[model samples]
Target: MASSLTKDSATPAPEKTFLGHPIGLATLFMTEMWERFSYYGMRALLVLYLVSGGADAATGSQGGGLGYTAAISTAIYSVYVALVYLMAMPGGWFGDRVWGARKTVAIAGSVIMVGHVALALPGQISFFVGLLLVAAGSGLLKANISTMVGHLYKGVDDPRRDSGFTLFYIGINVGAFAAPLVIGTIGETVNWHIGFLLAAVGMGIGLLVFLLAGRTLDPKSSQVPNPLTPAERKAVIVKGLAVAAVVAVFYTAVTMAGMFTIKWALYPITIAGLIIPVAVLVRIKRDKDLTPGEQGKMSAYIWFFVAAAVFWMIYDQGGSTLSLFGDKNSERSLFGWEVPTVIFQSLNPLFVVALAPIFATVWVLLARRNREPSTIVKFSVALAIVGASFFVFAIPLSQTAGNDTKVTMWWLVLIFLMHTVAELCLSPVGLSVTTKMAPQKYSSQMMGVWFLAVTAGDCITGLLGLAEVKMNGVGVILFQAAAAALAGLAIYMYRKKVDALVEGTK
Candidate 1:
């Protein structure tokens, strides 16, 4: 099947346009929006649900939580999120070599829906199983969808490309914003299982949209970019099985020795998160078929990837650390009704929805004037801005320490606002630059490679959660802020060299 698909020629760009871009963008946008709705909805509830003690007899309230400590819950959260992105490598590989992006996305979405359904079922075993399934599905879906968006453009230099990505980004945040408001409320105030069920419905809608409208997409997107030979397929399967077997054996040995607590088990994932990118870099560098320009661009991409990882390491805390802070440390009263902590999760995506168009327009205008900042510059600025937000947050946290006084929820709002701005500077631009930088044969795989930044950052965020248990919140925030700011400064100092390596990609 893969060999047959490889014979098809690249499809021409569609004549139809959605808001002056390719019509396929609309299909992808709706599909991704609903996919995110499912993902973010579940995420908003995960940590809180894990730490919840079920059914307080005094209050006659029912809560079916796992009763895990914050440290354990956060460790689990980190590993889950990290694995979600880490799986993107194989997802992209499957899209490029086996099923093609269109079919891969369809398969992934179905798996995600089943995962959510599993979470909706009763039992501790089912809950863990659900998480594993969802993470695997998300990893498979994430990169391929973004790759399809890149396919909607003429080329990397298409004037519409960045704005298209920014618009697509808005779709992502729209789902993210709505998910918490809808799913978070249900999960926190009502039955958690019902909330999980709703998430499955969202994925169902996403899959339906894709199946119905997918033909409008670039026909080439449905063709395997690089089909593997029969021998290569056997080799890949054998290697994959061997690795899985090794991991299973090691984990079994640790469990037998009584050293396999959840926190301890996560160490391998954390190490792999750090190591995989380095290995990928080495692999890309050794690709003898790559032109000098592609090699140089890959070099620049490494710095960008590191910067992005740092950015996500902080930004992703909204689901874990910040969610806990909202629950325990913030004043949630509004007109005598206490707000759900998970509702606060909506703010970042809300800001993104409100801000994306403005940023998109600004970039287009700047490009017209030939004054658009380079991707490296944008990344540096974003890092510093995001770091500054943590500094601002630390100020308020310091004042409220050692006392029962809770800070106003407005502080979190302020932080999310800053994060949205910083995200505008980096995320969409990162997507655009990635598509611009990749070699044709390795296109989808490179998109998967790009997501490794998120994987590494998320892994670090989990590790930091452990530290946060021992240290005061202020100290952790301060340390993270300093690290981010220093990274931004370092990138700024080397911006010229990085830009040169990009070879005029912007």
Candidate 2:
């Protein structure tokens, strides 16, 4: 039987225990929130740490940093951030084929904790190695955790599903919202290594809580719905190990040969980023099990994915160039206290925390009234808004600041708010739709497919930030704006057709 209901449907209707969702929701919520705290905490400090100089702090010298040029620092940031999402492919595969989501999340969480701890140690070797560990761990954990959240729900059309994910996303922002204020301040004001340690402690707490809430999930919650035979498993493992070994050796050779530039890493990442997600969509559309309707939905999803990549490419600058601007050019006075530059990183997540509930409610009310924006419509709006944000910043480019000009804080504030609203319109909705439209057999893998766009976006965002070392910030912002506006316009023009394909879900 081609069951339209999800794998979890046979279980009893879940009792409402946490905010009108199941008790397990709370566990995943808390785990994800704290995990994000660690991730974003580290992220808020990463680029700043890289570009900082040493042996002085009184004159606002970014001393004690890695002391790299902005270009190289952002390049490194781009690659690390790209891999964080790119690795989700193999991580999701492992969960679906072998370890199951539970073990994958547990193992990945531990690895990330260790990575943060390593980052706290003083040395260049520790820094790179710690980044590698954290990237790999995040790959293994992120998509799978979102997959597990989907596992807790049983219906494709459950009214509460989007809201549930919305709540889960709110938890993510709570962590994100706090990370800049806590770890970012610590890294920026106190000591960089101490900030890293704070991140590690946050992850450790999340892991402990996850372990303690062991029974919150259904006994089989983490299992692969389509388990492989022993022969199949053995073949997959052998192939995976061989690939891993080859990649490790190739990168080692490149680094040793002094050929491992960001461009070297980026070229393949860009290629694979396109290949992976396009291939996933192709496979999904061609799946024998999908009804014609499902195939239509899959097409709509491809459009949404592309739209999201556009949104993220522009949005990610909030962490990179925007953060740099805050550190160097933006006026940081809030209530007459000079805010630490790291505080700017909090704006997106802070807005997300404030905006998500309203968006969630808005979606439901519109759905009930048959006035809901089609997902494509929401995506187009996101694109236009993201573009406008850059345009907004672009307008103030020459505003009388000679390496000392604090452009009105309102400029950055408005930009962050626009980006956040775009993200609210796009991100959680994307996560929900990935769960809804994905084939049951490849559930977690689809989440990975979605993140591949993020991987590409991060890479591109880095390149854009890197260009600021050579290019003017105003020109860069204008480029971003034009690109997003074009993409949004294209999608908006074809939205009626898109709406038809996405007929089943809002």
Candidate 3:
């Protein structure tokens, strides 16, 4: 059956790159690069815009935000990030069972472009509409693009698999590296809307590229589920998009209802939404066809979900907690030139680009020696490092007291370096684990479930930030550090069992 699709079958060889790697691989990389650029560029500004208050000469507004307190803004930002990932479940479902990856990506790209354009418009109406489209579009793009990348490999064991993914990961960082500087500069120097407009333009480039070369996906691999029947596909898409729209409306209502303004409503609504999915996951555990090994892996995956949520709560600090810390606590002058805080956000991705190649060689060398740490072991290290980075922040807090004197900027540099290294251990590997452990039928939805942790983490991280404002600053850093360390400890304690579950894979 596999040979039927391939042009060469003598040795039963798999797909080959037009150069040295699969052609499809490059297409997905560029498409995702622009998509990530749009997402991260917006992220670079989100918290700052929210907290700094978007007021500027062109915006012609004072206190440039929705007038929410810091905590409320963080919570909103967290939930928005979470929902973008969570929605991917349905987005993947649409791609796998309805549109196929190609069409799904195109539609998603176009919609996201529209969303960015809407964000360029003024007023709450535009803001809400733009966010809704962004969430929906991201859902459509996120999982499908990864799925398409998997299509480039003929089998799970392909040697180029990890390298291809690593290359693809590089593309993501490339976009991330460029975004904050490009959009941040425009938004900070000229207008916030212009920054959003730049994101829309980036998405446009991605859309054009994907549309032009989309046929690289033809004779589509079995990895992609067959397209739905015409009638069935149409019905599912219409129904799915409608359901997504409804979900967006609900999310907007719950998230925008500021905590202080309506704490009672937001709390219950958020809890209910979170609990429902967890309950569904629990029900899946009882399915009879799943091997015990599979069940065990899924259970471990849940813990991973928890770990990732915790990880992001700390890791995503680049945009929120870290950004604020830099703004107020650190000395930002580089040779007497003060740079925008947003530019500082670009540091992690820059470090990633510089270090990922070195790390990839290290992993391969370790794997060859049969000494590569188990996925859970790597995750433990990741969490531990992430937790430890907070101590860097604590140094500034302890030393900066009683004076207007600034802490050395290297403290921020050192912290981001540690965070980036830990991410090399956790984030990409975590996503890879989801693709590996998930049952074939549930791949995309499960990936979405994995991202749900991110959403949850974002919410919790905001709570942590709120606590920082109210509690002792050094104490806050210590607490976050403790949380990350505890997460690593939990995984370390379960290492034996978790290792057994993910063995021979992940």
Q: Any runs in candidate 2 off by more than 4 Å, and if so which?
A: 1-22, 54-59, 150-166, 222-224, 255-267, 283-295, 365-369, 400-403, 439-444, 463-472
- Using lDDT, rank the candidates from best to worst: 1, 2, 3
Question: Which stretches in model 3 have alpha-carbon errors above 4 Å?
Answer: 1-19, 54-67, 153-161, 219-269, 398-405, 439-444, 462-472, 501-506
TM-score of each model, paired residue for residue: 0.87, 0.86, 0.83
Ten contiguous residues minimizing lDDT sum, candidate 2: 54-63
Residues 109-130 of candidate 3 have per-residue lDDT tens digits of: 9999999898888776787578
Candidate structures ordered by TM-score, highest first: 1, 2, 3
Tens digit per residue, CA lDDT, model 1, 1-506? 77666655455544888899998999999999999999999999998888777321112223688877666677778879999999999888899899999999999999999999999998877888899899999988986998899888888899999789878877998999899999888988898999999999999999999999988898878999989999999999999999999989988998899887666657777788878988987898789999988888888998999999999998887787777767767888999988888898898887777787799789999999999998989999999999998999897788767666688988888988898899999988898799899987677577778889988898887776555463237888899999999999999999999999988877
lDDT of 2 by residue, 461-503 (tens): 6665445452225766688799999999999999889888878
Q: Return the TM-score for candidate 1, rounded to 2 decimals.
A: 0.87
For model 3, the local distance difference test gives 0.76
Clashes of each: 0, 3, 5
- Candidate 3 minimal-lDDT segment of 10 residues: 54-63
TM-score of 3: 0.83
CA lDDT of each prediction against the hidden true structure: 0.86, 0.80, 0.76
